[model samples]
Target: MRKRLLTEVEGVVAAPVERVWRALLDDRPAYEMTTELGDHTVAYQGGWWYRGEWSVTAHPEGARVVLRVYNVADRLGWGVPLANRFFVGFGARTRQTFAEGLTALGERLGCPSRLLP
Candidate 1:
């Protein structure tokens, strides 16, 4: 069985959900496993313990983009906490990267984008 340890971040873009979805598809990573949740959501699982999910939904300003990352480790799952503290700033890095992505997406779509609190 795989154990999932989740970290999430979200942002809003001043564009249609379809546009955001298309952009997400264009930049998706190549993963070992894929799950299509719906027209607006997709998930990819790869490596020994990585899964990423992306989704777009309607928001008051425009479209909301959500990104979720999971450590889906089949083995040594319990080591994640130790690794997180000693090896990498996982959550911080994810947030920084996601913020950059949102900025780039906004530039691509000619719309404004911002991370949610």
Candidate 2:
């Protein structure tokens, strides 16, 4: 039996879509991309086990990033959904992690992005 957590949060970037994409995604050609957090590619656009589904879309004068992290589990008969709810800390941490990542991405790209609360 196993369990996982999934959290969904969105933030706005005050830079052009292309620029934001390049910065956060290392200039990947497609919207589907992976994030390198040290040696682990824990974040991805397409979703993975215990990982996250990361998406980027263009908005007026900027872009928006959406993250959904989840996993399948058997911790109980209730499965991953119940586990996720019980572990609220994971969601909070995920939010902060993504927020920081977005901020760092903007800095690395040389175009600052404002994270919408």
> Which candidate wins on TM-score?
1
Model 1: colliding residue pairs: none
Candidate 1 Cα deviation (angstroms), residue 88: 3.5
How well is each residue in 3-116 modelled by candidate 1, as lDDT tens digits?
465689999999999898898789876544756567798978766677788889999999999988888777887776667778578888888999999999999999999999
Q: Model 2, 62: alpha-carbon shift in Å?
A: 0.6
Which runs of model 1 end up more than 4 angstroms from their true locations? 1-3, 30-37
| Model 2 lDDT per residue over 1-117, tens place | 132445687787777766665565563435665444422123543333454656678867478877777663333435555555677787788888878887887777666666556
TM-score of 1: 0.87
Q: Least lDDT summed over 10 consecutive residues: which range in candidate 2?
A: 38-47
Top lDDT: which candidate number?
1
TM-score of each: 0.87, 0.62
